[model samples]
Target chain A: MPIIAAQGLTMRFPRVTALDRLDVSVEAGVVGLVGANGAGKSTLIKILLGLLPPTEGRASVLGLDIAREGAAIRERVGFMPEYDCLPPDVSATEFVVHMARMCGLPPPAARERAADVLRHVGLYEERYRPIGGYSTGMKQKVKLAQALVHDPQLVFLDEPTNGLDPAGRDEMLALIRRIGSEFGISVLVTSHLLGELERVCDHVVIIDGGKLLRSQAVESFTAVSGVLTVEVQDGRDALGEHLHAQGVAVRPEGRVLVVDIAGERTYDLIRDGVADLGLHLVRLEQRRHHIEDVFTS
Target chain B: MSTSTIHDIGYRRYDGPRLGRGYLVRSLYVHNVRAVWGLGRPARAKVMPFLLAAVMVAPAFMDVGAVLLTDRAEVLMRYSAYAIYLQVVVSIFVASQAPVLASRELRFHVVPLYFSRPIAPLPFVLAKFAAMVTALLTMTAVPVVVLYVGGLIAKVPHPLTHLREFLLALVGCALFALVIGALGMAVAVLTPRRGFGVAAVIAVFLLSSAVVLLVQNIAEFRTNFSLAGNAGYFAPFNLVDIVQVRLLGAERTAEAVPDGFISGVLALLLCAALVGGAVAVLYRRFRKAGLS
Candidate 1:
């Protein structure tokens, strides 16, 4: 069963409509909600979490009606907001324990879960230090630890990789994937960067200007294209000219030549052309369509 | 050294008993109360509240000391008039701590985290409101209790009468805590910045008391005592004082208090309105903040 289902969900602010007749149903796994800023990603999450009432239509989370059973739904869900919401004065352990209690965990259970989740998030001895002194990467880890400390069935992580460096971003993405696969928790993570989501999400839902643009599996969005990418050590211009004379559709894309595949002959033609030119072959492989190509196309 | 393998227990799901809304509210209330006292926080956060609490209880200790030394009943401070005597300290305590309880979450954008849980906005606001009231009650009642206990130790005459006055003064403290806590929270929640919240809370108390005192003095100078008494309702300290003097049979501390049983009932209703109105405002404020 789909963990989240929405129908004609609309959110209208006075000056602008944040969401317009949006409909989306997502199965449990690592699902990505991809949208630009002001594309109603946060609004849709708020509606799904039952924090905001929709102007029209209906939705359900974990098979419970969002309009009526929000409390019950929230009982099983965790949320990590995009903005900086941690109080700087308290240590990470203290804050996460408090959040655990907020989710109705008993005192002992709250403390234990807080410790366990902090450890899982790679925060050990430094968890005792005040969050005010934490780096941006450490703070994000703390935020993530609090969300998981409650032992939720599903978690909503809104832009969890925001404000992180490249290494931190990769670590956060890996952690999010583990949350879905190893932790056995369904994750609905949002990001504006499609490439990042492509790496972690099993299904990607793209929205633009408060409307659904596309919703498909990650494999479908990144399926192998019918073009081959050819790279050579030298004589790149000669290779392109030779491939063109052989009636092969080829174009130079930087150091590589993009050749439209004409059956299996395209590979043989590239191999023979490189051999005849005495140019060392670096790579010859079919290019897969990227998630970004969906937007550009 | 022998090679050892690290164990990976993995993430464990909590299949234990999950408590209900009441438990969540209780946890939030406890957390807020501790925050108000700066417990579980840095030592620097503890300094202001502890210093103010010491300042609050010092005079009672001095009064007890004087009674022990002089053996005179008059040396003991009046029970109902204790808060009024140390009104500045109480106000400072409320001003400083109200922001700690009311605005900390708002300033840090933590309200959404709470609302996203199973708790509703009303209960969230009520828990905070209750925490502020609890903090204020403890601040005001501890000294009065110390004074009473010290009096008993010092052996003031008519122990029963002292007990009755002490009980009535305890009631007065509740009223004071409720009214002042409500007003301070209402003011502080509007200012999300801690410094601004503190300034705003203190300014509300100071400005309202000053205006009411000015009006009371002018009315008394004109020999319109009833008008002066009615003006006392405008200030939070004097509002609760009216309830103490008129309804609880305590000695009047304010310059003038409205006469008769009807005035006392009206003062009680006004106190209720203040608390109810503040709760409503807080509910709306937090609900809006949660969405933001």
Candidate 2:
């Protein structure tokens, strides 16, 4: 069953409608919510978390109604917010342990679980240091640690890679992927950058202007489009002309030629054309569709 | 010849039973209580509360010494008048620490983290309210306890009377804590900035008292009968004092409100109103703040 299901959920802020009748059901996996800023990604997550009541329609997380069962749902789900929400005065261990206790762990269990989760999130001795003295990456790790300390069945990571350098982003993404794959924990991770989600998400949901643009498995999302990218060793200009002469829609994209796939014969035509011109065909492959293509196409 | 691998401390799911909502409230209460006194915070955070508490307790010790040295009961400050006497220190305590309890969460945007858990917004707010009240109670009651013990240690005559008065002073202290705590928390929630919250809490007390005193003095000088006695109602501290004097049967020292059964009822009603109004404001503020 889908872990989170929303039916025409709409959230109207004072000035803008953050979610406009957004209907999407997220299955249990590493699901990526891809959208631009103000594209209703955070709004949908807030509604699912029962933090904000939707202006219209209904939603559910873990099969529990968001309106009536928010507390119960929150008991089972964890959230790592996009912005900083930790107390700088407290140490990471103290904060996470407190969060674990807030999630209903007894004192000793809370402390033990906090330590384990902090370790999982790659925080070491610095976990005892005040968060005020830590780097942004360390603070983010603490936020992640607190979210996971409760051992929630599902986790909502909102821009988890935000404010991180490249290596930090990679580490965070790897951690998120492991959370889904190894631990069997459902993850609904949001990012504006499509490439990051493409690496970790089993499924991708693209949103734009507070509306669902596309939702599909990650494999289907990057499935081959009806276009082939052809790269020749030399005479790239000649290759474009040759493909054009064959009544094919072809355009030069840098060192390669992008040809519209007319049918199965398009591949054969490209092959025969390459032979006819005596030019070395360095690469010929079906162009993979990107999540950004959902918006552009 | 040794094969020792690094301990694999990767992610592990907690299948342990989750406790109920009461735990959330209790944990928040404990955390906020510690936060109020800066127990787990930096040493610098400890200075203001401890300093004020020490200053408050020192007077009681000195009062006992004076009683001992002079062999007179006149040196003893009245039990019920303790809060009124140390009103400035108490107000500073409230003003300085209420923000730590009420405003710091909002300032750091950590409120959303709390609401995202099983904890509801009302309980979260109530926990903060309870913590501030406890902190205020400690600040007020510790000195009262000191005075009571010192009075007994000095062997003041009518020991039973001193104990009874001490008990009554504790009741008065509780009322003071509730009223001041409510007002401080209500003011602190208006802004997320600690400095602004502190300034606003102080202004609510000091400004109201200053205005009421100015008005009272003017009315007395100008022979305005209506404003002379009733002006004390304008300040929360003075209103609390009026309650301590009339309803609690404590002797009126500073406030000049006329003594009557109706005055006692009015003071009680106003105390209830202040507390109720503060809770109402906080509930409304937190309803919006839960998501903010």
Candidate 3:
């Protein structure tokens, strides 16, 4: 069953409509909610979490009605907000343990889980220091640790990779992947960076200006295109000319030659042409579509 | 020659019992109580509250010392009038700590994290209110208890009568805590910045008392004692003093308190109103902050 299902959800603010008739359903793996700024990604998460009431329509989380059973849904789900919400005065261990108790864990369980999750997030010795002294990367890890300390079946992580450097971003993405696969927890993560989500998400839901633009599996969004990319050590012009002479549509893009696959003959044509020119072949592979191509197309 | 391999312990799900809403409220209340006294915080945070508390309790020790030196029971300070004599210290304690309890979460954007849990706004606000009231009660009641113990140790006359008055004063301390705590929280929550919150709370307490005293003195100069008595309603400390003197039969501390049983009932009702109104305002404030 889908973990989250919404039907004709509409949210209207005074001067603007944040979400308009958004109907989307998400199954339990690592799902990504992709949207630009002001595209209502946070609004949709709030609605699902039952923190905000929709102007119209209905939704359910984990088969509980969001409008009526919000408290129950919240009891079972955890949320990590995008903004900086940690108090500067307390250590990470203290804050996460307090948050764990807020989720109704007993005292001993709260302390134990706080330690376990902090370790999992790669914060060992630094977890004892005050949160104010932490870097942006460390603070984000603390926020994530607090969310997971409650041991919820699913978690909503909003822009978890925000304000992270390249290495930190990669580590966070890898952590998110492990949360879904290794930890056996369903995750609904939101991000505006399409490429980053493409690397981690199994399904990507794209929204634009508070409306659903596209929702599908990442594989479908980036399926193999009918083009072959041929890269050689030298004589790129020679490869393009030879492929065109064999009645195959070919174009040179940067150092590589893009050839339109006509049939099985396309591969043989490129191999014979490269050998004839005595050029060293470096790469030969089928080109695949990217998530960015969905917008450009 | 080691043959044992390392075991990979992955994430473990919590299948244990998850307590209900009452546990969450209790945890929040305990946390806020600790915050008010700066417990579980840095050493610097503990200085203000402890210093003010020592200042609050010092006079009780001095009064007891005087009784022992003079060897006269009548020289002891009145038990019921303890909080009023130390009113400024109590006000400072409330002013400094109210911001820690009411506005710290709002200023740091932590309210949304709590609301996203299973708890609702009413329970959250009530827990905070209860914590503040508890802190204030402890602050005000400790000195009164000290004075009573010192009275016993000093061997003052009419010890049984002293016990009765001590019990009555304990009731007064509770009323003082409730009324002043509610007003301070109401004022502090309106200003999210801690410095502004502290200033605003102190301003409310000082300005209201000053204005009420000015009005009462002017009315007394004109021989309008009734009007002077009614003016006590404007200040939180005097407002509860009226309830104490008229209803609880304690000695009057303020310049004038409204006369008769009806006036006492009205004062109690106003105290109740202040508490209820503060809770309502806090609920709205936190709910809005959560959404933001």
lDDT per residue (tens digit) for residues B191-218 in model 1: 8888889889888887888889899999
For model 2, the superposed segments whose C-alpha errors exceed 4 Å read A13-15, A239-250, A259-282, B1-7, B217-227
- TM-score rank order: 1, 3, 2
lDDT against the true structure, per candidate, is 0.91, 0.86, 0.91
RMSD of 3: 2.3
TM-scores of all predicted structures:
0.97, 0.93, 0.97
The digit string of per-residue lDDT tens for model 2 on A211-297 reads 888889999988988888999998889878888887999999999999999988898889989999999989999889787778777
- After the best TM-score superposition of candidate 3, give how far the Cα of residue B179 lies from its true spot, in angstroms: 1.0
* Segments in model 1 whose C-alpha atoms lie over 4 Å from true places: B1-7
Leading candidate by DockQ: 1
- The residue pairs in collision within model 2 are none
Off by over 4 Å in 3: B1-7
- Evaluate candidate 3 and give its CAPRI docking class based on DockQ: medium
Looking at model 1, give its docking quality level: medium
| TM-score of candidate 1 against the unseen true structure | 0.97
